[model samples]
Target chain A: MHNEKVDILLIEGNDYEAKLALHNLKKHNLTNNLLHLRDGEQAADYIFATGEYEGRDISNRPKVVLLDINLPKMNGMEILKKIKSDERTRTIPVVILTSSRENRDVAEGYALGANSYIVKPIEFGSFSETITSLGLYWAIMNQEAPYIPNNLWQSISEA
Target chain B: MKNILLMKFFSTAAVTPKRFHFSAQKSEFEISHIPFKDSGVSVVNSSGQLLVAKQEIDTIETKPVMRTLHNARKIAEDAIIKNCPDVICALDRKGRFLTINDACVLWGYSPEEIEGKFFTDFVVADDIEKTLKAACACISTGKRTSIDNRCAHKEGHSIPMLWSVSWSADDNLFYCSGRDASDIKSAEISLQESTQRYRSLFDYNPDAVYSLDLKGNFTSANAKVAELTGCPIDQILTMSFVPFVDPEYMSVAAESFRKAAAGEKISYDLVIIDISGNRRHLNISNMPMIVHGKFTGIYGVAKDISESEANKAELKKLNESLEMKIMERTSQLEQSIKEMEAFSYSVSHDLRAPLRIINGYTKLLSNEYEGKFDADGKEFMTAIIENTKYMSRLIDDLLNLSRLGREAINKTIVDMNLITQVVIHELKMEDNSIVADFKIQDLSPTVCDQRLIRQVWTNLISNAIKYSKKKGTPQIEIGSYEKGNQTVYYIKDNGAGFDMKFAAKLFGVFVRLHDRSEFDGTGVGLALVQRIISKHGGKVWANGKVDEGAVFYFSLPNS
Candidate 1:
């Protein structure tokens, strides 16, 4: 039930892109399971439970993070590095949805541990369709990383 | 009579007919004659040798001896009077010809006419004083002296003659021999004229003409050389060429003069210092001076070329600056092109964001308010959505065109058959409700940018299917053939083809041959195809007939 609650995290630089991406994901019936973070810094904070997201349950990791490269405080490559470096959220998938097909950001994003790189098309129809399929792929079809609750994690360590 | 007889006795005694050996006394003629041959008059025997003056000699020889002396005098006068090569004449103290030889006829005068004529009258007036001086000298010295004077002919022309005159004191007469000298005089005159012409040429020539003696010392230099040095000719002649030549070329001038003095002709370029101390370039040609097969000196001519040399240097400098200017302009153009590429990327990303939102909101409006809007409002929203979609496609096509200029080609071996099949399958899948009968032919492989070539296939196959879908069971044929050095791939479709006359407008970015009601699309497909094909160094063309079918072909390099 805890894994079912915190489903996907959307880190989008543009508000419109985030709205469309969420709209597409909600169309796939993943509305209650999705969380929209504004920028890479806020996304990192939400994942690590720091800054504005302090004292939050850190173990309730989302199934996937849809990251956009062009962000305000911390760009996607930096945030991807932070999440992939941490063992707690390292196994969670982070897919890049960006407006830029510029090879520099794409190559850097993958090297910094992005799972998939997708270009946000300007046509709303195709844009929403790509996000919908990616959402279904990550939330429904994809297997989640094993989560060990606090009690179970402590006991497994003792054994 | 006794003197006449004595004359005949002397003649007989001086020229005896027989060999008579006589020894005469030193004082006079106390002589003894021993004649062994027969003698007309008998001489005495050796003991008594005296023979009295012959009383018979007076009777026998007076008339004959007198006649013989007269005949000998006439012979000597005749010998002096006749002349062939020389005109013989006798002149008095006043230089009058008393007796003239027959050779006077050579001057159109007879001996009788010239006799008793004043010899000075036949002499040219210009030579009269000289002739008179020679006559006086002849009388005083009584020796042969020569005079070259012109003599007047009877025809009013003068001929040069060389006269040899001598005085005979005994006869109180001067004898003269006159010889023609016309040829020698004319030869001397021509030689003087030739020397004058050569001197005029040297003085008037614009170039500096100078001559050096065998020691490389200046003998004579023309006025031009003086003008160059700003010195008079006499002063230039006194000065050697060394002072006028620049110090850098002083040794070279010396070497060249040495060569010329050795009877070798040489020429060289040198720099000289002018009166103002400015350096001037000069070309000097030196040749050995030979006179009558004897080495005389070296003659040379110099020409100033300083202005022309300066022009050559200026032209070279201009050419170098021109090359630099061209390079600068080329770099400026390249900078503008790079800035334009960045601007194209900005247009692609930033401009499309709003268009996407416009399109996304319209979709939401239609979905949320399914029946809230009337049919007119709904249709208007659809139009907005369609127009937004077209604008997005225009941005993409424009980006592709500008990107072709910016990005380098990433070439690979592209298989046309597989690419055509993939394009066809993708085109049908994008609109799966449509049916297409694709006739694909054998296609060869090519080396090109795989992504751009795939774009080419995508635009072309989609165009074919979109246009031909109006027909029942739309038929499309994809084939390739070989042309000169290239392979041409064609897509033929049974479609609503365009008029051939408007084919030129088909590839324009915003041009649409068909109405929006008949076909729903932007006109960027063919333009994108053209851009991609040309980026691969190829060409594209389309042929279509109204109500018939259409075929689009594109070419690429075989390798």
Candidate 2:
């Protein structure tokens, strides 16, 4: 499991929301290497290779991280800060997918360096369409940052 | 003896037969005769002495003439002593009264009773030593001495006496004259006491008290004046008050001084810099010092008021801080309201996800198990989907109502006639099958939020059309008029109007007058209209009668 390369990292606390997002992503055949974490802490552990995810390869980063603002344990904002602040994972695209349309949340999400901010729709058809389009755009169409070898990235960070 | 010598000479002259002039030349008498006109004659000698002459000799009657001369001298001595008002007395060397005048009776003593008594016996005990000392001084120095002493009267009361005594060396006596001084003594005592009282009043006063001369130099100042200026009394007396006065108040001080010097009393307030260089505010009053009807200079008193000025400044600062605090609290209240609205919006957003899931699953079940289910099962699924959709609509309406509370109204001048026309055109396009007569009147323009006012028109006109569609021939009338400072617009319909009793609840949220079977509505359109009008500082109302007609009105400020 630690040796596999992941494509999408979905951090969602609610079971129904997680199921819906995964089902929609699967229906579109976006990625087979998707990893779903129930809370912000597990997502941080898996991303930073700390605590339960210690000894995992430190450079096998995901292509995109889908985040919810309201989560158990560490919340989505703290996880975003952790992911964006680290040099190894800084280039990974973070998309904020939450049920909140508050102006403050959108502003805070963008201010913390979120790549994309999308509000989750309430109707099933709209929610399905939004999730499916997001998968297609981030996983298939958009170009990701060029990856550097682990030792080379360490040398660059040191410089 | 002199009278006898005069008698001898007159007897010799009476025997001579001529008018004789007697002249004494070196202890001898020279008698000469001149031509005589009568038997008895009188002449004056060259030394202005009187001489008597008689033609007949009278040597035998000389004794009787001497007796008459002595009696005449006695009468003259008695007249001099009887008329004098002062007590004139002669004292012996031993301080005894040798001879007292008739004026001794004024002291309740006759001259005869006082003549042999010691003078010290009549002097009061308190003054006996001073009186004896004056007598002794007069005798020893042979000079006149004056003393004030109380003399004991015979009636047991004392008289204040001022006495003058002289020592006569030849006679070995002291001649004394005394006068009553009771009135002058009492007047002097009262004057001294009053002067002391006024001096203390000036010294002990809390305010600085001082007097100036005609030259504006301090003539006299009390203890408080020295304390107030932080200067010594001598220094203040030498210096003019001009140096102590603050530069700004120099003119005011001069004017007050001029008024006081012109015989007018004046008072004023000024700031002064004391010797220690501290600023003090003083309220001063001055009075004219007049002596014998002439104006002199100023009298002043000053009270310190710096503390009160500072307190006034402090109170003004406190009032400003209080206003700032009120503003801060108001902004805090607004922030909390915004937070609460955000919480409700999130809650409404979160509620939709479950509803969507339910609607989605029910549809899938109905479509997938179409052949296996009965008619009742299909109907249940449909009911669930419809109700879920209705709930979703309710959430959206609630969110819109809450959002309106926080929305900033952007106001502009809008043409009510054009807004009504556009709304009517839209309503007709929405339902072309409905037939009605529309009466549109000239509507006034008003200042309002254009978009919100358009919503108000749409809600009112749509309500009018929906409620009147059952009529045989629906009639809808739209118009506006100027009412006071407001532009009032009304939409009237000849339709199934509500009862007048429930008119008060017409604009309340979720309050519907008719059953859902008769009328289809969310009961939020009128509420939204009411809220929009209120936000624009306007009003909304309605008038109705069951089955007759209904008229809905809204008013906006003209400016």
Model 1: DockQ vs. true structure: 0.33
**Regions more than 4 Å wrong, model 2:** A1-7, A24-31, A48-50, A54-64, A80-94, A110-117, A141-159, B1-339, B369-373, B415-444, B461-478, B492-496, B517-520, B547-549
For model 1, what fraction of the real interface contacts is kept? 0.43
Which tens-of-lDDT digit does each residue in B315-414 have in candidate 2?
9999999999999998999899979886776667578767877876676577667888899989998889878877877777777777788889998888
Report the C-alpha displacement of residue A58, candidate 1, in angstroms: 9.6
Alpha-carbon local distance difference test for all models? 0.78, 0.81
Model 1 spans > 4 angstroms off: A1-9, A24-65, A72-94, A111-113, A122-129, A132-159, B1-273, B279-335, B368-381, B409-454, B457-465, B468-495, B533-544, B550-559
- TM-scores for every predicted model: 0.53, 0.52
The all-Cα superposition gives candidate 2 an RMSD in Å to the true structure of 20.9
TM-score of 1: 0.53
Pairs with backbone N, CA or C atoms under 3 Å apart (clashes), candidate 1:
none
